[model samples]
Target: MYLLMMLSAAVVSYTATWGARYVGNRMELFSPIRSRDMHSTPVSRLGGLGIFAGFAVALLIASQSFFVKDIFRNNDAPWGILAGAAVIVAVGVADDLLDLRWWIKLIGQSAAALVVAVWGVRMTIIPFIPEPYVIDSDAVSIALTAGLIVTTMNAFNFIDGLDGLAAGVAIIGGTAFFLTAYWVHRTAILLDRSDLATLLTAVLVGACIGFLPHNWFPAKIFMGDSGAMLIGLIMASAGIVSTGQITSGLYDRANGIPTIIPILLPFAVLFLPLLDLGLAVVRRTALGRSPWSADRGHLHHKLLDIGYSHRSAVILMYLWTCVLAFGGLALAVFQWQVVMAVNLAAMTVMAGVTAWPYLRHKAPGLGPRSSAEEE
Candidate 1:
């Protein structure tokens, strides 16, 4: 049933993207080429509309499914998620067309997150503490939830510079999250505890997969802020829902590693984007610029600067994301020692790949001239 729902979303999103492309062209809603932009041509940034269409339709279908109808009947999280998605998409579309100020976009993102947090998707406990620390204050819970969603939205938005980068990363992270949630459901003592998380991740992954073809290199359309933030909002919501109601007992029985894996997995899965966000903020602030200032100093841009092709740069980041995400996920189901060993090996390989350009340049008669020499 979940598979069917995912497929339905993919089909709807794929179809909707064509429509969005048509509307964008007709309306002249193309994103302007900036100094930091890779593409010289203006591309429609309305792909987010298509993603939302697919995501919304998928959830609607899930709500009707006999296998998962209980998610709607017993919980308000799904409704909150849907409402938040709608809010972000509208804000994103506006930003894509009008180039709204950063603060304005932040306000919109916060409002969207609040809708979900208030609707019962807020975090209830800190997952890594020896004993789960229950959040007793509603205000604090809502703030934390909103902050996470906003940060995630911005992180994704930060990394959306490359064609299909955001969507591909979302698919990787979402799939890992889905698997983790499903594992939690299987081992969970309580029934349906992780169902919402599982369902959300499934649909999120499907939406990205459906949108990827059009958004790939030599892109037909861009997801713009709307699609990127939408992906972040949903991914964060899934993480929150997965851990919101979970007890320490679930972790105790699930693995030999510490119970921290449940909460830590989301951070690990999104490590690359969050890392990019952190570095960008620090780099900009040190230079007396607004953290929201745009520049070509992003990780993807650095990749290109260092001689990686557009597709290669995007794929390498995807590889890095998978290594972190799945490596962290392995701790949940596999022995800590084995997971650590595998992760270390994967990271070593990735590091070599990431530094390949420099390595080849430094090697004697190995490859073409470096990007520096070419420039």
Candidate 2:
């Protein structure tokens, strides 16, 4: 059933992207090439609209399915998610077209987060404490949820520099999330628990997969801020809705995984972008610049500088995201010691590849220097 829905969303999104590209070109809505831009040719930045269409339509179809009838009949959270997605996409489209100021974009993100919070998708539990505690203050819950949503949106936007980077990461991260949520739903004893989170993640992954062809390196159209933030918002909301609603006792601990897996998993899936976002802010602020200031100092830029091709850099990042995200998921279903061993091995390989340029440079007569090395 889930597979069918995912495929449907994928097909719709793939078709919609063609239409979006055509409209964007006809209307002269190409993304402006900047000094830091990876692409030289003008490309439409309207791919987000295609993604939104796919996601929204998928949910509407799911709403009518008997299999997930309870999810729709009982929970308002899905509607909130849809509404929030629309809000962010609108903000993203405006920014794509008009180049809105950072504060203005922030405001749009907050509004979208608030919409989801109001519909009961806000964070309710504080994880990582020895004894997980429920958040009793409504204000605090809303604030935390909004902060997470906004942070993720920006984190994803920060990493959208490379073609297919954001969407590929989204597909990988969203799949891990969906698996985690599905595992929870299957294991939980509670009959009233909703699978809304699982459904959302599946649809989100499908949309990204569908859009990837158009957004790949030497792309036809960019998802821009709209698609990137929409992906972030949906990913964050799935985590909040699934993990936040469950208590620590409900987490499956038979596999020797910590109870904090529910909360930790989301952060792990998003680790790369969030890490990138954090580093960018610190780098900019220390230089007496606005944290939102654009530069060629991003991780992808560093990869290009280090002699990685555009495709290879993006794929390497995808590998990093998978290693972290699925590695985190492994803890929930496998023994911690085993998962840790596997993760260590994976990270070692990733680090080696990432540092290959420097390693080759230090070893004379290894090979001819690449263009980046010569520069």
Candidate 3:
């Protein structure tokens, strides 16, 4: 069933994206190149429509499965999430077409988040407390959930500056969380508890993979704000459903990492984007500019400044995201401090290797000298 849904999603996504690309210019759905933009050419901005189409189709088919049906029957979350995703995609499409104001976009995002929060998914508990502190208050839970939705949506939006950057990271992050959700579901947790997360993550992975070929370097179709924000909301929804709402079902051993994974998994999977988001906010505010002010100071931009080509910079970020995301997964699955430490060390080594070329010039004569220098 899962396999079928995945294949269906990929095919639908590819077809939809191809169609969008075909009519993008005629429809005025091409994103204009700007000084702050990475692409030199205008490209289709409705790629999010492709992604959303794939996800929606796959989800509708998957909903026929017994487990999927059971979850939907038991709660309104499944429908609510769909509704919210639709809202986001609509907002994204509008943004692509009309270039909506930042606040207007935020309002749309807030509405969607509220839909998800009040209907089914919410961070109703904080794992850090000595005893699990359930946030039973409706207002507080909804507010917190909405904040998370906005932050996550903006995080992915901020990182979508490069071809395949956002899509690749989404694939990696979604895979990691999907694995975690699957493992817990099969081994330690109940089927219903993890089904939504696992299924949603699977859909997320398929959608990204399907769209990646078109969005790769010299991108033919940009996901634009619509696709980025939609994926962000999906990721956030999976995290909330799989972990946040299942706080009481967390592993009992407080001394180990698995016990804390319910809280850490989301952060670990999305560390890079979240970091970029944080840095952007801080840097922009410090410069006395609106936090949403556009600039070329992103981590990917820095990679370009340091001589990495667009594709290389994107692949490097993919590697970093995988390391952190899988590290979190390993911590959850094995609960071994030593294993996580080793993973962290290996990630550091990878980072060093990636940076070595940039630093090679600093060590005079250490790197191959150019012919001009030899002369």
lDDT tens per residue, model 2, 225-280? 99999999999998887677546455656276455787788999999999999999
Write out the backbone clash pairs for model 1. Answer: none
The segments of candidate 3 whose C-alpha lies over 4 angstroms from its true place after superposition are 189-194, 245-255, 372-375
lDDT of 2: 0.88
Q: lDDT at 57 for candidate 1?
A: 98
Residue by residue across 1-375, what tens digits does model 1's lDDT show? 777878988999999999999999998888778888999988999999999999999999889887777789877889889999999999999999999998998999999999989984998888755666889999999999999999999999999999989999999988898888778667767765538888988998999999999999989999999999999999899888767655746666546655577778889888998999999999999999999989889999999988899999999999998999998888888888888999999999999989989788788977786799889
Error of 1 at 363 (Å): 4.6
lDDT values, one for every candidate: 0.89, 0.88, 0.83
Tell me the RMSD of model 1 versus the true structure. 2.8
* Residue-pair clashes, model 3: 0
Give the runs in model 1 whose Cα sits over 4 Å from its true position. Answer: 189-194, 363-375
Lowest lDDT block of 10, candidate 1: 245-254
Instruction: Compose the digit string of candidate 3's lDDT tens values, residues 45-102.
Output: 8899899989998888877765556656667787788889999999998988888887
The TM-scores of all predictions, comma-separated, are 0.95, 0.95, 0.94
lDDT, model 3? 0.83
Evaluated at residue 353, the lDDT of candidate 3 is 74
CA shift of 4, model 1, Å: 1.2
Residue-level lDDT for 245 in candidate 1: 51
